[model samples]
Target: MKSSEVTSLSPPPFSQVLSMPTSNQGWPEDFGFQLGGTGPSYILSVEEGSSAHLAGLQAGDQVLEIEGHNVSTLGPQAVIAIAQTQKNIPPSIGVVSRIQQV
Candidate 1:
């Protein structure tokens, strides 16, 4: 998919904000979740009982923003870098959960 593309239909997608408190290192890995994809990064996995899972982040959920910064044009690595450098104690992440319709 292109950097501007999101896996969704018309009427927009279901988006939510999750406030996740990170460890002293301030890394997503510390929150027990991994990110994947180039631009418009998505959650690769979420560990059970971890902060990410408790925050409602699920695998396949596309990351829309990090700490209010639009990240749809950024790659996964860039997003991770932003997360690591953010000064926010508990960063607010905006994400869109892609629900598969059977």
Candidate 2:
């Protein structure tokens, strides 16, 4: 997907918001989405019914922010750090997607 038609993902189509728990003994820990690349990453894929899937994430979505930090301003390490912090929260990050047009 190209960034030309990028748009913010809000009030997602499914209306199923999700978050990560701080800790769990046997939660299996599946956020359901595979975020690949180092900086300016894209979601390579999203598992069905996973938190990522429920929260409206999908393949080809461009991750725009995490927590509240812009991915562009922060380097890959910083972005990774922000993502790490969200391990215990819901809506871990904000992402832009071309799929919105669909």
Candidate 3:
């Protein structure tokens, strides 16, 4: 993807998103898409009112890790490919809840 393609306010193409690695490692507890483009590093651009954005994930925070996997090396395409193998995953983010919170 080109640098001009990705904007901080818009969600990139499906090719730019990644799924949380199912590996039994120390991955981050949250989930969302990773913005891909020429820049300093990886970033998480949460959809407006999404679980991630609602949870306080800003547009510029560097994504350190996902499912304990170092995203810095996987890049955008690799991550999106991995995430695609999973079924029924939403474009916004991934989550698992036990029950409704009081």
Candidate 4:
């Protein structure tokens, strides 16, 4: 994907979205961005068939928000925790800043 081709998309939630694959990190099967780096949590990669990838999330995109809150201050754990609390993976929105060219 080209960096110049960033797209802001709200991918439709699929029926497969569930807590079937729970991560040891306390996240469900919905959001699949690997968190890491120096300061803020940056998207390392998006799983090919994950809900996050289907939602237009890309590797290198800066995670700006989780749900309706800006997690830049609260951090990714707090954001991820929200997803962990749901029985059924609820619809959560992520605001990422990246332009993909794929």
Candidate 5:
């Protein structure tokens, strides 16, 4: 899909949201862009000050995988799994997403 046509998908369902962190990175003048990338099933938002943010995730970057695990296929279920089990995701964790200029 064209980048403009690719609407940013909503976060994983609310039930699974709590499993992920709640920290909010400061609001940017314009949030960076992310196009629901691929890999394992887990995807997450990096809170402004949280470690995830420092690693480079913007508001819409998709957590396509952790280590080598696939995240795009598992969807919300996979995200919960990562949030619950992994605490120190690498800075490269979100590279799979096909982010675009906003």
Candidate 6:
């Protein structure tokens, strides 16, 4: 079977929205999640007990949108830049959670 056929046979990824509020300092790190990826930025890690962790963000979650901006085709830096633009308000992050198949 082709790679496309194999991919099609797998279940589709599910999406979830995370409302993460930044700290008073308003920095990307304050959001408690590390982002990494070139195209389609993804969450590298979620700090324990942090806003992102509480908001249900997990490592490997593919970022679909950030603060209402589509980031599906953006690099990590661009995505982080968009995230940094938000101040005290909680930014709505759209993510696709992929489940690893055994």
Among the numbered candidates, top lDDT falls to 1
After superposition, candidate 5 runs with Cα above 4 Å error: 1-44, 86-92
Flag regions of model 2 displaced more than 4 Å.
1-20, 23-29, 73-78, 86-88, 99-102
Best by TM-score: 1
| Clash counts for the predictions, in order | 0, 1, 2, 5, 13, 0
* After superposition, candidate 6 runs with Cα above 4 Å error: 1-26
How many clashing residue pairs, candidate 4? 5
Per-residue accuracy of model 2 over 1-102 as CA lDDT, tens digit each: 755876887764865555556643222235666666666777788888787677788897877877666785454455655666554555357777856663
lDDT of 3: 0.44
Estimate, for each residue in 11-100, the C-alpha lDDT of model 6 and write its tens digit: 677465545543433544777778888897888898887778888999989999877788999988888778767653557789998648
Model 5 Cα lDDT, one tens digit per residue, 19-56: 23332121121122222224433224545644455456
Q: Candidate 5's error at 68, in angstroms? A: 1.3
Q: Write the per-residue lDDT of candidate 1 for residues 1-102, one digit (tens) a residue.
A: 657756965786636554465442656777878888888798999988777898899999999998999997788889888877777754678999975868
Model 5 misses residue 38 by how many Å? 13
TM-score to native of every candidate shown: 0.72, 0.58, 0.39, 0.54, 0.42, 0.68
Residue 21, model 4: Cα distance from true site in angstroms: 6.0
- Give one digit per residue, the lDDT tens place, for model 4 in 1-102: 656867899988775743435443335333566765454666777788776777787777776665656666445566566655545544355656755777
In model 2, how many backbone clashes occur? Answer: 1
lDDT of 3 by residue, 9-99 (tens): 7656664444444441211223443455343234445565444555665555554444444554555555555444444332223232222
Cα error of candidate 2 at position 20, Å: 5.2
Candidate number that wins on lDDT, 4 or 5: 4
TM-score of candidate 1 against the unseen true structure:
0.72
Error of 1 at 102 (Å): 2.0
lDDT of each: 0.80, 0.64, 0.44, 0.60, 0.42, 0.76
